[model samples]
Target chain A: MTPKRKQKLFVILGLVSLAAIAVGLTLYALRSNINLFFSPVQIAAGEAPIERQIRAGGMVKEGTVARDPDSLDVAFTVTDYVDDLEVRYSGILPDLFREGQGVVVVGQLQPDGWLKADQVLARHDENYMPPEVAQALEEAGYSPADYQAKAAEVGERLGAEAVGESGN
Target chain B: MWSFIHKLGSPRWFYAISARLMPWFWVAAALLIAVGSVWGLAFAPADYQQGNSFRIIYVHVPAAFLAQSVFVGMAVAGLVFMVWKIKVADMAAAMMAPLGAAMTFIALFSGAVWGVPTWGTWWMWDARLTSMLILLFLYLGVIALRGAFASRDSGSRAASVLAMVGVINIPIIKYSVDWWYTLHQPASFSVTSRPTMPLEMWAPLLIMVLGFYCFFIAVTLMRTRSEILRRESNKRWVRDLAVEGR
Candidate 1:
């Protein structure tokens, strides 16, 4: 190769090597932080440091919820069925939050073992179902068939009224 | 003055100066990192609220700082390449990609780790977090665009444009937390604001930031030097350097 061409080729090759080294070093340096994610069970088993803010995911246990009358703070229980944690949230609960739903609470553990949450996240279900209440119910071992049937009945009544109006 | 800038822009001149300083950068990075890490990790008192887990901030904060600062550096490099037609500037911009990306990832990951203990969630779409995520994507896009073209020059030019465009977004991202309701807190440390942290806390953090910059320079120089060698491989000096050593 000509000198100019060779120089260009060398430069490109060198950059690739440099990038590789930087990436390798960074990963090596921060390996511990990278492995910090843990499940609720792992956290409860003392695998995670108690003082660290951790995420607890699973169903909000039914009938364990209480909202402070004066404050916006709401307290609820979360369970993986095998392990359970009480979580207190002092913010606006997402519209989807309810009993027996799959929710993730992000916050730190208080001295009393209750999860003091900064945020509460509610994930919806597939099949066009608003998983908010249902997920919570399902987590609490309740069937959604009753709610679904009630909704269908309401829809049918509305449809009948619309048809009568067209005929008139 | 313009000629001076042009002279400094020369790869040969940069190679000479950077080579002279590379060892010093390495020494500084190593020493500062060692001292800061030791002080911050081992000696720094546990946060009144967070206890010991807050120690991660020593690395996390520095990485976060470097992640943002390097992009600014890359953007400056992009501007030089566009205005002055400096190939070295383009090269610097290109070289910054992986480093910036890695630092961004480090910041994100460390933030997540810190979040889990303090906030209780592994991730959130908070303003600062979201902006940092976009920065990661921007870094990826620049690197990808640089390698996308059939011709290397075309690739570098494309990457330069992308870098400049992304630079415009940085200020928007930085100010978004203040403007918008965000779960992420506003910046704790700044050039003007009185630091919220005590001397013990802020002191180590400052040392870490300096160490990170030194580390950045050391790595960049090593990469740039290697780049020079590879690009100039067929040149007489490169051949002699290779042959003399081998």
Candidate 2:
């Protein structure tokens, strides 16, 4: 082979091998740790790793939030409308965090079967269907077409309500 | 294969070719960004929770994506320079560093701003935020290191090595929120991953992401051409073009 061809072969071989090693190492290291959050169903199915910090994400069950009368401690149940996990947090929550909103709590599960959350983040309010919720909804057979059509139907109902309210 | 590399290595050949490509990218960038920005800010329905503040995602997500992508692009160019002794690759890497750095800054700034009203904090040294900060530093380090060396060849080689080494950080930045406990949300836009948003909300964001990519390409082509003229001023072909004044 000519010198140029030899150099090209050498470089390509070297880079491909280097890239393969990098990919191999990265996949191995990240495979177990790649989950950003766990759902109530995953926890119920004994899939969530225990005692290690991970996020538990689900909707805050309606009327389940209980705040301490004197302190910042708050307790709530997170549910996918399928299974439920109880989360107790002692710190102030995000302003947008409220009852029935999608939430993620960062903490570890106590052996007693409750999540001791160091931080609780409400994903947003009632109307905000975050990607996690969207995924969950999809698993339940909801699609974008269904969501858009439902939104239009709601918008029309709201418009009619406003018109009647003004007429009265 | 050798002939293709040889042709691409020539500044005159690249300059002529990229001139043809750049205009199309510029036009596309302008049209897409304009349309995406308008659609996202006005036409898209307000979020049920955050309301209009969520519109920032149009600029923020695209900026953050580009910031990481440009760093990886710089690393590939550096690898090309190191392995093949490609002068054009080194030139492109040098031009890309500052732009990548600027994009990283924008992403961090926008993220921080978005946080104040949402997270109620200006900053947090969480995994995602910290990794992105390190990416910005890596970009600056490459730019500064390249300029620090007295010999151009040594500087180019040094920058290439740094760029290639920094390649490890790209995936870390991408997966940091997922792998570690952090307040920052996980990846939103993925080919295999479905966004929680309905089509109305995410469509403008997709357009914005495409526009930002075109913007990166158009600017990189313009800057690389400038670098070529500066580096190859002594070449006969460059001198002829200057003489023709065309």
Winner by lDDT: 2
lDDT of each: 0.71, 0.77
lDDT of 1 by residue, A1-168 (tens): 457656655664465456556655764575434332333444455544565677655567779889999999899887655556888889887655678655667788766677778778753221122235436656898775242343234335534554565568
Stretches of candidate 1 off by over 4 Å are: A1-168, B1-5
Expressed as tens digits, the lDDT of each residue in B1-246 for candidate 2 is 878667878888889988998999999999999999999999887764566778878898899889988988988888777766778988988988888898899999998887776765657666688779989998988998998989999888888777777777787788776555455766767677787577888899999999999999999999999999999999998899899995
- TM for every model, in the order presented, reads 0.61, 0.72
Clashes of each: 22, 1
Best by DockQ: 2
Q: How far is candidate 2 from the true structure (C-alpha RMSD, Å)?
A: 11.2
Best-performing candidate as measured by TM-score: 2
What TM-score would candidate 2 get against the native?
Answer: 0.72
iRMS of candidate 2, one decimal? 6.2
Model 1 chain A worst lDDT run, 10 consecutive residues: A123-132
